[model samples]
Target: MHDLIEALLLGIIEGITEFLPISSTGHLLIAERWLGHRSDLFNIAIQAGAILAVVLIYRERLWQLAMAFLRPGHAAAMADARVYGQPPREYAYRLAAAFGVTAVLGVLVKKLGFELPTEVAPIAWALLAGAVWMVLAEQLAARRAAVLGERAAITWTVAILVGVAQVVAGVFPGTSRSAATIFVALLAGTTSRAAATEFAFLVGIPTMFAAAAYELVDVVGSGEAAHEDWSALGVAFVASAITAFAAVKWLLRYIQTHRFTVFAVYRAVLGLALLALVPAAD
Candidate 1:
């Protein structure tokens, strides 16, 4: 009973934070520390369900993608970002590029296992850096109302630039991939609403799916998370999906009137609190 209840609470937490620009990874670490539960692959695997929430929420667009890229008659430049005046798909191409860049860079970094220790300090640095960037992001959001008109199209230049930003995001688990990419979008003249919401879903689609895929591979190869635990996985996933959907809706509404600085500040404070509280072994 305790295990199941703990699973539900953590699932809800993951669902809430996963979509937010604040770091879910950081929150998970904090949860482990505070909950006093032995963390395991079960908690990590629950993210697959959170990922599914995004995919299913945007099922309409994903279906459109199936038609756009898979079918020959679909000439919707909407997917191209360069010519399509419509949102998402135009934005999606940009996201794909960004995800691709991050994937390549992340893979290389994982392979090299660079001399720089994978310490918790980087997470602290990311939280602090993201907070500082949020101040700039607010200014960009205010300016974007007038700016996107002259720069309507999402050009390859912006794609590459956003991609580079994603690479920076990948290096630091607490940086929040959605926050990084959306900041790029907002700075590049996409409206705050469009950039914040679309970038959240668009970049998140591939990013989350890829992460799920990799974890699946790891689980398969090492039996880290068993196929036999599918039932438990399902429970966590459904809870996560419900929570994620609610969180995404709330976040979209919040971004309309609120600047991101509050969340950023929260991340920094939380990061510091964790550093002070958690033992050095962590």
Candidate 2:
């Protein structure tokens, strides 16, 4: 019963923090230190649940992208007719390029064994750094708003830039993937918050699934899965899915009217609090 409760609590934390500019991994690490750590497989699996929520929420867009990929003639017709706001083909290409760059860079980093500390102190520092970047990104976005373009108008250069930012977020624990990608898009001249957020999450669906798959395979190969608590994991997975759907929905609505300054400040305060408390907790 205690384990079940812990799983649900951690799932709640994961769902709430995952889509927010605050790092979900960082929060999970801190929470686990108090509630007891879950296995890597369990963590990865619950993330898949959160991803399932994203898929359900964006089913319409996902269906359109699927049709565009499977039917080249339809894509061409849409492009020629300009039926959709943006050519599905162009959006598809940008998604591929952005995901490709991150995959390549991420694999290389893993091959090189470039890993960071999962310690709370390091996460605290990373949170501070991320906060600074967020503030600066908002300022830059405001200045360039007039000249900025929408998601469909993103160029190859911007896609690559945003992809690199995703890679950086992967490399750094406290850096939030959504925050990094969205800011890079904004800085790269994406004026519309909705457009940037949409692209970021769309690309995120595949990237996250790939990571979860890799982790699951590794755990299974290592025979670690046999030791995990399946019941607790199931509870966490369901809890994460429900909360993630709500959290993401709220964030999408929130960004439509507000700047990211609130998130930035929250990061700063949380980071400072962690810096002070983590050492004492030890």
Clashing pairs counted in every model: 0, 0
lDDT of each: 0.67, 0.85
Candidate 2 structure lDDT: 0.85
lDDT of 1 at 148: 47
TM for every model, in the order presented, reads 0.81, 0.94
Segments in model 1 whose C-alpha atoms lie over 4 Å from true places? 36-44, 71-92, 114-122, 144-152, 226-232, 275-282
Q: How many pairs of residues in model 1 come into backbone collision?
A: 0
What TM-score does structure 2 among the candidates reach? 0.94
The digit string of per-residue lDDT tens for model 2 on 1-282 reads 998999999988888888788888888888888999789988997798889989998887887777777986775676342212567777878888999998899899889998767688988989999999999989988878855534336677778988898889888889999899999988886777888888888889988998898888999999999999999999999999999999999999999899999999999999999999976866
**In TM-score terms, which candidate is top?**
2
